[model samples]
Target: MKERGQQVDQNSESFTFLGKGTDFKGVVSFGGTIRIDGRVEGEIHTTGTLIVGEHAMIQGIVSVGVLMNSGKIHGTITAVEKIQILKPGVLVGDIRTPVIAIEEGSRFHGMCDMGAHLGSGERALSLDMAPGLVATAQ
Candidate 1:
């Protein structure tokens, strides 16, 4: 029996969510998806997925399998799989990934390292952005 308004195919992976008004500092590591809508001022490492909400702010090193962001981030980020920054997201720092997608209205300014991932047979993120988007990489 499914509850009303429930998602038809909700993800089974339980994730940790840091909602608004929450502020965390130090290292946060998890194996499942995590959604942040607050502020984090330290390292965040995960082996699954990380979602940064529009109101979120993060600063420091981030290592994850996948990342979807619509907030603001400043630091060194390493995503083993891919990274997607949606509209209004702003990322300012160095990123090491093989595949990265920045949509229109997003912003990114940093250096990208993708060669290491290609030769290691590992997936990665990129430094590409669509038109009307602000992106600068080295």
Candidate 2:
């Protein structure tokens, strides 16, 4: 019925929605997708996607698998997969993710670490150990 990796077509999915005028504090965690359109102060951790609506304002830490933001966020964000900042989004904090997309009207003012190291068990091939029948061949 519902898919996890599908970006769009979230209507079919059963997601958690925090509408406008809602206020929340402390940490929130869940699976699947969630949409926030209100004000939040504290941390949010999820293994699923997080969609921040245009009227949302979030502070503190955010850790999720994927993030789609169209609001204002002032804190650290760590996404395991990717992050998308849509139009009118304002993110004012550091982020760590493998992939990121910022729209033209979005504003991101902070550091971004796209992973300083390679994936697990992955490494650059050394010429010394590589065989190409060149001068380095012994």
Candidate 3:
């Protein structure tokens, strides 16, 4: 079991770090994992993981497989897998994820939509019938 854990850790993708005091603005799309400890303003989309270190600040739309935030984010977040907000973290935006874990002392001031079918391959259809009338079309 221990060897399996070690192997998993070794197989994990390396993280690209955005160190403290760095500021970036624009779109970021990548695979694997990324850790940010600075400030970012734009959109971030990835199919891996994102770790927002303490003292980090991000503002924009974020879509990822997994999100671990320990700082602040002000925008919309759509995580396919899960989202974890550590203690002292702050999120001022809406969240859409199937699983969410928020530690104590974290601040999330926005709406959260937790649906099991969120990332499922499903489509929503609109009805074009009258309000009080039923329509049957074959």
For each candidate, how many residue pairs have backbone atoms clashing (under 3 Å)? 8, 0, 0
* lDDT ranking from best candidate downward: 2, 1, 3
Q: Give the runs in model 1 whose Cα sits over 4 Å from its true position.
A: 1-11, 120-138
- Give the least accurate 10-residue stretch of model 1, judged by summed lDDT: 1-10
| Best-performing candidate as measured by lDDT | 2
lDDT for model 3 comes to 0.84
Which residues of candidate 3, in runs, are more than 4 Å off?
A: 1-12, 116-138
Give the TM-score ranking, best first.
1, 2, 3
**Alpha-carbon RMSD to native, per candidate:** 9.3, 8.4, 9.7
Instruction: State the lDDT of candidate 1 residue by residue for 1-138, as single tens digits.
Output: 111111222377767878877888889877788888889999999988999999999999999999999999999999999989999999999998878999999999999886646678655443343433434322
- Per-model TM-score versus the true fold: 0.78, 0.77, 0.76
Could you tell me how far off, in angstroms, the CA of residue 82 lies in candidate 3 after the best superposition? Answer: 0.5
What C-alpha lDDT values do all the predictions have? 0.85, 0.86, 0.84
Q: How well does candidate 1 score on lDDT at residue 138? A: 22
